[model samples]
Target: MPTIPSPRHAARRSLFQSGIGLRLALAALLSALVWLTIAWALAT
Candidate 1:
């Protein structure tokens, strides 16, 4: 019997295969920085 791949793995593979992984990563990093800025502003 062969092992089966998970859906999450398939989705991630497709993301990279289509060259969207880098864009997605950059978007996520930018979003995180925005949140960090907000938190810092509230803390200060």
Candidate 2:
């Protein structure tokens, strides 16, 4: 007989992958926002 994986394990793995990607994207966005804000403040 063959063995099968559980649904809970699969869901957890997918969630972990998505969480890492989301964090990276959020960090990039935040840095860009801060840089732009600083440039605008200096220009004014």
Candidate 3:
């Protein structure tokens, strides 16, 4: 029989999923866009 993953193991797996380099780059790009929008709003 296959054993199930415990809560901690599941959480760790998800953390690594988001820690991928491509995902990190995408997240950074999205954050930059949001900051730019906020800056433009404040300027106007």
Candidate 4:
């Protein structure tokens, strides 16, 4: 017998397989850090 997965399970499975979300989060964090550094330099 074959089982069908729900929408949530499918989404989680895709994320686990490809890790696109993780990469995006890492990129966003790096960008924020760079912007913060620039702002701090300008303020000082």
Q: Name the candidate that leads on lDDT.
A: 2
- On the 0 to 100 scale, the lDDT of residue 39 in model 2 is 100
TM-score-based ranking, best first?
2, 4, 1, 3
Q: Candidate 4: lDDT over CA atoms?
A: 0.87
Worst 10 residues of 3 by lDDT: 1-10
- For 1-44, candidate 2 gives per-residue lDDT tens digits of 22356777788899999999999999999999999999999999
Instruction: Please write out the lDDT profile of model 1 over residues 1-44, one tens digit for every residue.
Output: 23356777788799787787678888999999999999999999
Q: Give the TM-score of candidate 4.
A: 0.62
Per-candidate RMSD, Å: 7.5, 2.5, 6.0, 4.2
- How does residue 17 of candidate 2 score in lDDT? 99
Q: For this target, which candidate reaches the highest TM-score against the unseen true structure?
A: 2
Please, what are the lDDT tens digits per residue for candidate 3 over residues 1-44? 23456777888988898779778899999999999999999999
- Residue 14's C-alpha lDDT in candidate 4? 92
Off by over 4 Å in 3: 1-19
Q: Please give the lDDT score at residue 23 for candidate 2.
A: 100
Per-model TM-score, in order, reads 0.58, 0.65, 0.57, 0.62
